[model samples]
Target chain A: QKEVEQDPGPLSVPEGAIVSLNCTYSNSAFQYFMWYRQYSRKGPELLMYTYSSGNKEDGRFTAQVDKSSKYISLFIRDSQPSDSATYLCAMRRSNFGNEKLTFGTGTRLTIIP
Target chain B: EPEVTQTPSHQVTQMGQEVILRCVPISNHLYFYWYRQILGQKVEFLVSFYNNEISEKSEIFDDQFSVERPDGSNFTLKIRSTKLEDSAMYFCASSEVDSLRPGELFFGEGSRLTVL
Candidate 1:
């Protein structure tokens, strides 16, 4: 099995809808979790980050990690059309310098107007 | 906000030819990384560099691949002999501090390499 797994979603939702994206990992050592948003032809941009098992909130995004379940989630509130992009979940074992990241197959999301 | 920059936004190369993709990481960031995504596939880690040495690399980063911080500001990924399979979007990223505690990474726009 892949170390990290995410549904390759082409999920479409109306503007102002709430969106939830998720990723599951087989590795227990992964301690740092991050969500990245990538527009077409662009690189992944960091959106939300969380450490271990907890929830973190930023502007309109929330990241939740459940270590026991080896699952992580990114929730978008009041989603906008601008939020249409590929969402990637990445994890690493440590925060130490230059640690290689393991990434899931990205989920493509579209917010319809 | 400071951002990572990559050069030659697109590259077309013949098979077996050598290719070098360049990146300028955020000036103050000490950690650097290279990742690639084959069309429709997951983004895969290539290598990570810190303090002038490779700190880690993925299985995909084989002997055919090499990285160099040839200058103070530039980090580069060199593919010794390109293969059609090597055609992918290469992304460079850097973080101000180690990724501990959910530190974020700033990524370059990416260089699209098409191997023929």
Candidate 2:
């Protein structure tokens, strides 16, 4: 099994709809969780970050990590067409400079007008 | 705001040829990394560079791959011989510190390499 698993979603929703994206990991060692948004032909851009387990809110975006369940989520409120992109979940076990990140396949989301 | 920058927005190379992808990491940042994404695959880590040497590399980063900080401002990933599988979008990222304290990475626009 892959270290991280995310539903490769082509989920489409209307503007203003709430969107929930999630990922599950089998590695109990992963302590740092992050969400990245990637636009077509562009690199992944950091959107939200969380340490260990807890919920973090940033304006219209909220990131929730449940270490006990080995699950992480990103909730988007008042989603807009501009929010269309690929959402990727990534995690790492250490703060060490050489630590490599494990990433999920990513979910493709689209907010329709 | 300062950000990472990559050269040659796109590259088309023939199989078996050497290709060097260049990146200028954000100044003042100490950690640099290379990642590649196949057309429909997840971003895969290639290698991480710190203190003028490779800190870690993924299994995908084999003997045919190399990284160098030939200058103070540039970090490069060189593929000894390209294969069709090498076609992908290559990204360079850097962080002020490692993955601690919300260590955020700034990624370059990416270099699209098409190996034919």
Candidate 3:
């Protein structure tokens, strides 16, 4: 099994709808969780970040990590068409200085107008 | 805002030919990395460099691959001989701190490699 697993979704939602994206990880040591949004032909842009099993909110985005299940999720509130992009879940073990980040296959999301 | 920039946005090479992909990371960043994504696949980490040396590398980063910070600002990934499987979108990333907390990384747009 892959260290990190995410559904390759072309999830379509209406504007102003709430969207939830998730990823499951098998690496018990992953302590840092992040969500990145990638537009077509562009690099992944950091959207949400959490250090442990908890929630962090920024603007319309929220990131939650459940260490017990090794599951992480990204919730988008009041979604907009501009939010259409691929969302990537990435994680890494803490303080392993210079350890590379492991990324899951991104989920493509489309916000319809 | 400063961003990671890469050169030769697209490259086409023949199998067995050497190719060097170049990147200039954020000036304040100290940690550098190379990651690749084959068509319709997950992004895979290749190697990480810090303090002018490779700190870690995945098994996929075999002897055929090497990295160098030939200058103060330029970080390059060189493939000794390209293979058919090496055709992918190569991304360069960097972090300002060594700590993995929150895992903040800045990535380049990416260089697409097509091996013929």
Chain A (alone) TM-scores for all candidate structures: 0.98, 0.97, 0.97
How do the residues A9-70 of candidate 2 rate in per-residue lDDT, one tens digit apiece?
A: 88999999999999999999899999999998788899998985889999999999999999
Each candidate structure's TM-score, on Cα atoms with residue i matched to residue i, is: 0.96, 0.96, 0.97
lDDT of 2 by residue, B78-114 (tens): 9999999999999999987744454467789999999
Question: What is the C-alpha lDDT profile of model 1 across A1-113, one tens digit per residue?
Answer: 88999999889999999999999999999999989899999999888778858889999999999999999999999999999999999998987766777899999999999
lDDT of candidate 3 over A1-113, digit per residue (tens): 88999999889999999999999999898988889999988888888889868888999999999999999999999999999999999998875567788999999999999
| Superposition error at A72 for model 2 (Å) | 0.5
The residue-by-residue lDDT of candidate 1 on B1-116, one tens digit each, is 78899988999999999999999999998889999999999999899888898988989999999999999999999999999999999999998774444447788999999999
Q: Is candidate 1 or candidate 2 better by DockQ?
A: 1
Pairs in clash, predicted candidate 1: A95-B99, A95-B100
- Give lDDT: candidate 1, residue A30: 94
Per-candidate alpha-carbon RMSD to the true structure: 1.3, 1.3, 1.3
How does model 3 score by TM-score? 0.97
Proportion of native contacts found in each model?
0.71, 0.59, 0.69
After TM-score superposition, the amount by which residue A8's alpha carbon in candidate 1 deviates from its true location, in angstroms, is 0.7
